[model samples]
Target: MRLATIHADEGTQAVGVDLSQDEPRFVRLRDEDLGSRPSMIDILSEPDGLHRAESAFNAGRAAGDFVEGRLAAPVPLPGKVLCIGLNYRDHAVETGAEIPSEPVCFVKFSSCVIGPGDPIVLPRVSSKVDFEAELVVVIGKRGKHISKESAFEHVAGYTIGHDVSARDWQKGRPGGQWTLGKNPDSFAPLGPYLVTPDEVGDPHALDVTLSLNGQTMQSGSTKEFIFGIDELIAHVSQLITLEPGDVIFTGTPPGVGDARTPPVYLQGGDHVEISIDDLGTLSNPVVAEPD
Candidate 1:
């Protein structure tokens, strides 16, 4: 089932689209046990909760009169948003980086998150803003010391993610880490909808492509990932506790602005669209920082 969280006047709420009826059906999940604040994150915490929500979504899609509209990201506020770098073989090659034995990880502040069609704000500090289209994994249940054998069981769903970066801040900075370069306002474009693990099947087999201002920039497949989801889970869990709604960016493919001959950084009013087979598409506009 495709689940999403739409931002309406009331607030962000869990919703599903009924393709058959062509309408929108909000999750009428009156969590009698948890009260009115039945947030997506809170619901995703329990393994059973995901199952129940999927069941509810299926039932609603069948029974309700569905309206056609855009779906937002399933998780509203993730506890932690961790990302992996250099996991894709072609991406690593294009960027002139070596393949790592272990997953290279990073963090993106939740504040960078924007809906699929939202505007991306290019920071004034860096003129070399680039885009990295990635597949984001949403955790189902909390787990620590998670084994690779059981890692897939802890996954809730998968969604398309655009890892917007400030190339200058990321490379030419004197910082100890890549935080400042990565975490700019409206840097991450997520959503369209979250497809359940069952629907997604093998995450590593999907086709991923990215376009900048309607020009095809990145075109690759998930098959080139150096470290798949299972390895990432086991490796990261060894150090920290993994919780529900914690998103993991499974790296990106080749063809970013920074990897070009002379480099082709994002200019004002650029549009980026990331498409992943089965999961759906994530599109957004890039706007320059206000003068």
Candidate 2:
């Protein structure tokens, strides 16, 4: 079952999505058990959250209609937003960076997150903002020192992620301010829905692509990943504890704007759309930060 967080009269509520019919239907998960105005994290953190959500979704009560501008990030305030860089062999080749034996990880704070239909504000300080399409893994269960063999046990599902970057701050600064370059407001656009693992078979076999305006800029497969999901989980858990709602952006493929001959950076009035095989498309418009 697919899940999402949406704005309602009661406030932000977690919802289960039904796509069986011609038009998609949404049912609010009876999360009264979770407390007032529970977020997606609160629901998924419960031991039988998904099961309860599934039961509620199948109850066939009045289905709620999606309100315009009501969809929010599935895990709006994730405790941690971990990102992997250069985990794709093709991506590394395009950037002319060496393939590392260990996973290259980074963090994007919650302040950077936004949902579908949101505008990606192009910061005035940076002139080389770029886009990356990535497949995000959402953790369902908490675990420390999770093994590669047991990694799937911790997975809740998957979602599409857009890792927006400001190349000038990311690499041109005094010492390369990765966090500053990456953590700008609305830099991480995630959601549409958080699809269950059962619905997204073999995450590593999916096709990922990103388009700017109407042209495809990046296209590649997870099959080119140098460090797969299981390995990434096992590698990171050895140090940091994995909690429910924590997400890992599994890196982007080649064809990044920075690698193009006359690098194509984002400008005002551009639309960015990212799509994965089973996961849905995450689209956002770009606007210049007001003076």
Candidate 3:
């Protein structure tokens, strides 16, 4: 099942589960649960909520329960937006970086997250904004020191993510820390929908691609991940406690703009669309910061 968060009446939001026949269709969770507004985070954090919701969804949605609001980042207020760097073989190879024995991790502030169709603002301080299309993993259960053997058991599902970057701050900064370069406002655009694990078999088997202005830029597969999801979860859990609604951006494929012959940074009006098989497409338009 595909889940989404969409605008509702009077500055509110509602959880929507897709019950499409051909085109997209979403039934409001509140309409199913007696008007209680459940955020995507709320649904994920609950132990039995998703399953119960799925059962109710299968049972049926009333014709009046359908919604027509704009979608937001599925987990709009995720606890953390953790990301892995150099975890894709082709991506690492493109930058001439060595493959790591363990996952190289970083954090993108949750404040940087925006929903589908939102504008990706190129910061006024930087001219080298680049895009990294990544597959985001949404955690379903809380765990510490999670084992690789049971990591997937704690996964709620998968979604599409973009690790937008300011190349100058990322590489040429005073110190080489990645947070600042990656934490700019509107830097992380996620969603369209959150698909359950069962619906997305063998996460590593999916094809991932990114296109800039209708031209395919990055094309690869999760099979190329140097450190797979299981390893990433196990490794990160050893340090920080993983919780439901927390997300991990499992690196990007090769063909990033920064790796081009003459680096191709995003300019105002450029459109980026990243897609992963099973997961829906996430598209965002680039715009300069307001003067």
lDDT of 1: 0.81
RMSD of 3: 1.6
lDDT (tens digit, per residue) of candidate 3 on 173-212: 8887488899999999999888998888789988999999
The candidate 3 region of ten consecutive residues with least summed lDDT is: 10-19
276 Cα displacement, candidate 1 (Å): 0.3
Model 2 has a clash total of 0
lDDT of 2: 0.89
Candidate 2 residue runs with Cα over 4 Å from true position: 32-35, 60-69
Candidates in order have lDDT scores of 0.81, 0.89, 0.87
Tens-place lDDT digits, model 1, residues 52-140: 77566666555652333445566756788899999999889887888898999899998888887889998888888988999999998
Q: Write the per-residue lDDT of candidate 2 for residues 173-286, one digit (tens) a residue.
A: 999999999999999999889999999979999999999998999999999999989999999999999999999999999999999999999999999999998888899999
Best by lDDT: 2
Ranking of all candidate structures by their lDDT, best first: 2, 3, 1
Clashing pairs in 2: none
